[model samples]
Target: MAKKMLRSVLFACLGNICWSLIAEAAFRKLVTDQNVSDNWRIDSAATSTYDRGNPPDFRGQSCMKRHGTPMSHVAWWVTEEDFTTSDYILCMDESNLRDLKRKSNQVKNCKAKTELLGNYDPQKQLAIEDPYYGNDSDFEVVYQQCARCCRAFLEKAH
Candidate 1:
C-alpha cells in the first residue's frame, strides 16, 4: 500500500519556541490576509495531529496529550531528532541555528536554513533578527520581517 503524504508542514522556533504562538498567529494571518485555503494550514505543536482533522484547543495541556502533537506545528522545545525530520524548519535565533546545524550535520537530509524561507539576499543568506527580548518596536520589526519572508514563501508555494 502507498504511504500517507503530509499536507501541511511544521515550523521551527528558537529555544522552547514560545514564539510558535506568534508563528501560528502569523500563519493564520497569512492564510486569511493572503486568501489561502485552510486545507494547507499550519498549527502549533499544542494542536497538530497526524490523523488529520480539525484543530483542537489544548490551551492548558502539554503537547504530549492523548491527541498527540502533530509534526506540522512542532514547538521549538521539540527534540533535535524531531526538528531535523521536519519538511521545512524555521528558526528564531542564533542558538536555533546552531542546533539545526549540529543536527543537519548528523542527518544529511535536514536542509533547513536559518533564513526564514528559501528567499533572501541570494549570495548573502540574511537571517531575520530575533525580537524575543525587546519592546513593541522590536516586535513590530520582527513582525514586518516575518511577514515579508512569509509572503515570499506563500507566493512561491501558492
Candidate 2:
C-alpha cells in the first residue's frame, strides 16, 4: 500500500483563546469523526501575545460543550517555525491574515499557506468574529461558523 501523506494545520486568531481555539477543536473533532486522526495534525496559535498561556475563553468552552465539540486549549503566540512547518496556517479574519502575512515576511522559508478559515465555509461566510467582547450568544455563533468551515476544510483535505 502507498503511504498516506500526513498534513499539519495551524489555526490562528488574534488571541488563541477564542476563534482559533474553536477552529482547532472543530477540525480535530471532524478528523476524529472521519477516522483519519493519524493522517493529520491540528493545533491553534495566536497572532498577538495578549493571551499567551491562557486557556480558551470560558464562554467559548461553554459554547463548544453545548454543541458537543468540547475543547480545552492553552494560548501561544505564532512563531516563525509555525509558518515554516504547517501545511496550512488557517486564520479567522482579515486582521489575522494581515498579521500572519506580515510575520511571514520575517521568515525565510515560510511554507504554510496563510488564509482565512472562512474561505472553506460552504455557507460562504467571510470571517469568524472574535467573541471575547461578546456574550455566550456570540460564542455560539463562532461555534456554528467553525463547524461549517471545518467540515468543509476536512472534506477538501481528504
Candidate 3:
C-alpha cells in the first residue's frame, strides 16, 4: 500500500472578505463531500491588506449560511510563504491573479501555480467579481460562481 500525496491550495481575492472566503468554503465542502478532505490542504487569503485579521463580510457569511456552507476564516494577506507552500494559488479575478503573480515572482523558487479560480468554470466565466459593497443578492451571485468553479476545479484535480 502506498500513502497518497496531499495537495495544497490557497484561494485569494482583493480583500479576503467575500469572494475568496466563499471560494474557500465552497472548495472545502466539495472536498469533504467527496471524502477527500485528507488528501488536500485548503485556505484563503487576500492579495492586499485591506481587511487583514477581520472576519468575512456579513453578507457573505449570511449567503454561505443560506447555502449551508460553513465558513470561519479570519482575513489574512497573501505572504511569500504562501507562494512557496501551496501547490495551487487560486484567486478570484484578474486583479488578484496579477497580484499573486507579482508576489510569487519575488519569491525565489516559487512553487505555487497561481491562476484565476474562474478559469476552471465549466461555463467559461473568467472572473469572480468581488461582492464587498453589494447587497445579499450580490453575495448570492458570488456564492453560485464559487460553487461552480470550485466543483470544476476539484473534478479536474482528481
Poorest stretch of ten by lDDT in candidate 3? 128-137
lDDT of 1 by residue, 1-158 (tens): 86435435445555323344444555556666655645454544321223233232233123212223221332424344544455555655555556656666776455433334324223333465545465545545545555566666666655
Q: What is the lDDT of residue 86 in candidate 1?
A: 57
TM-score of each: 0.56, 0.96, 0.97
lDDT of 3: 0.90
Off by over 4 Å in 1: 1-7, 16-20, 41-76, 80-85, 107-115, 118-125
Question: Which residue pairs in model 1 clash with each other?
Answer: none
Global lDDT of each candidate? 0.46, 0.91, 0.90
- Please tell me which model should have the higher lDDT, number 1 or number 3: 3
> What is candidate 3's lDDT per residue for 1-158, written digit by digit as tens?
98889999999999888899999999998899999999999999999998889998989889999989988988999999998889999998888888888888899979998999999998898998888778999889988988999998988988
Local lDDT at 155 for model 2 = 84
The TM-score leader among the candidates is 3
**Preferred candidate (TM-score higher): 1 or 3:** 3
| Candidate scoring better on TM-score of 1 and 2 | 2
Q: Which of the numbered candidates is closest to the native, going by highest lDDT?
A: 2
Order the numbered candidates by TM-score, best leading. Answer: 3, 2, 1
